[model samples]
Target: MHGEPADEGQYTVVAKNPVDKVQASAKVSVCTKSKVDKLADVAVNIGENARIQCQYSGIPISTIIWYKDGKLIPTNDQRFVITQETPTLSVLTINNTDMDDKGVYSVKLTNTTGDVEGKVNLTVKPIKPAITRDLDTSYTGTKGEDLILSIAGTDNPYPTCQWVKNNTELTPTTDPRIQFKENKKTNEYFLIIKNATQNHMEEYQAQLINVSGLIKSKKNKITIQKQPTFIKKLQTIRVNQTDTGKMECQIDALPQTRVYF
Candidate 1:
């Protein structure tokens, strides 16, 4: 049928068309997938190629159109093409989907006599990687604090994770006090700091990088908890004795540490 309504419907003046008044006030008969009003849930990752299909069941078959952001997105954009063979409508192919593609998509069904609409939301997210860490890294001899460094997010594209300290890369192979470990299967990465030093007290970063050279998460700074230390010196007025507040503390650690108790 042409874009215009033209002479499509069975309607006319003064009983000119037999079916005009019979079905004028009634909606088109929907028997199949047309009973429902919307598409199924769709989840896609950024930079991935995805397809969204809308469906409706009816005996008379329905004509469908798709819209993005409320406007008709012609089947031209490389990221968006249309396929009609499938009941409701088909999103041909969305190439290189990105953050911008995340939104609500609508499918409009139009028949000579009536029309109906439905919508679906598209969500794009980076893969979350497995993560592990040495929770505590506090001590009197070295840097006084608990530390952990690693990006906990991962994906199928094999995310590149790096620890940043004061905007600098934190490499485990070279740094003696730092240990960086990653388990790809679990998508877990860990940063272990042994006998931390004052230098480890600086800003810590965990960045998740992908093949597309896109950084999903920026320098996620890891929090560090440093224990408080107190020193006291006391002198007795007995004119003969000098005393120092003998304050001694012992620390014991588990899994990722040592004990001084």
Candidate 2:
């Protein structure tokens, strides 16, 4: 039996008969079995490409098959491409990958001897944040008080928060008496308004932003109730000794405060 290439040589057997001698020769060849080298894990951001590569050694390098999560990947898929860097090295490249492409990937090298497999884990990192829920629609507060306007949302890498008041962006440091806060535990963002007044009783919104994009919550109306504000003070008029004396005042109040003498 032929064991290895070193053992492959001409084998001659001689037989001698009464008047003739016959000799026959045969040759044999042996090659190494298929073996797949170790592969490293791959990680790439969304919309980028992920490449998994491995090397194999055999007498004849056979076909390379790619599998994802134990399922065979179609070679005709445009997003998946196979390339051979050398006779023994093969690479599987996934283009424009997303979260769905994250899984364990295996490449099998098949030869006459047997099949050898290599595995690599693919991690597709989320690049952008997504807003799952917006902020509350309306909030009510009393004048001369502190108010907390909160908005809730979700994202991949956690999103930042901003507050918008009356169509103007409110910067925490620059804006007067306004503070921006975030609750990482609950993923809630807040716009704290101190000394809220009638001026703050307008449309307010919270903006959740991240590397992906920015999303504004629905317009939140802040209904601020204040005490009576008198536009014109009471005026007194005397009509010559016992003629009718009348007093009148002009006032403005939220929720229409009742006025009495």
- lDDT (CA) for every model shown? 0.59, 0.80
Alpha-carbon TM-score of each model against the true structure: 0.39, 0.52
Clash count for candidate 1 is 16
Residue 47, model 2: lDDT of: 78
Name every residue pair that clashes in candidate 2: none
Residue range with the least summed lDDT across 10 consecutive positions in model 1 = 133-142
Q: Compute the lDDT of residue 17 as modeled in candidate 1.
A: 68
TM-score of 1: 0.39
- Shift in Å, residue 155, candidate 2: 9.3
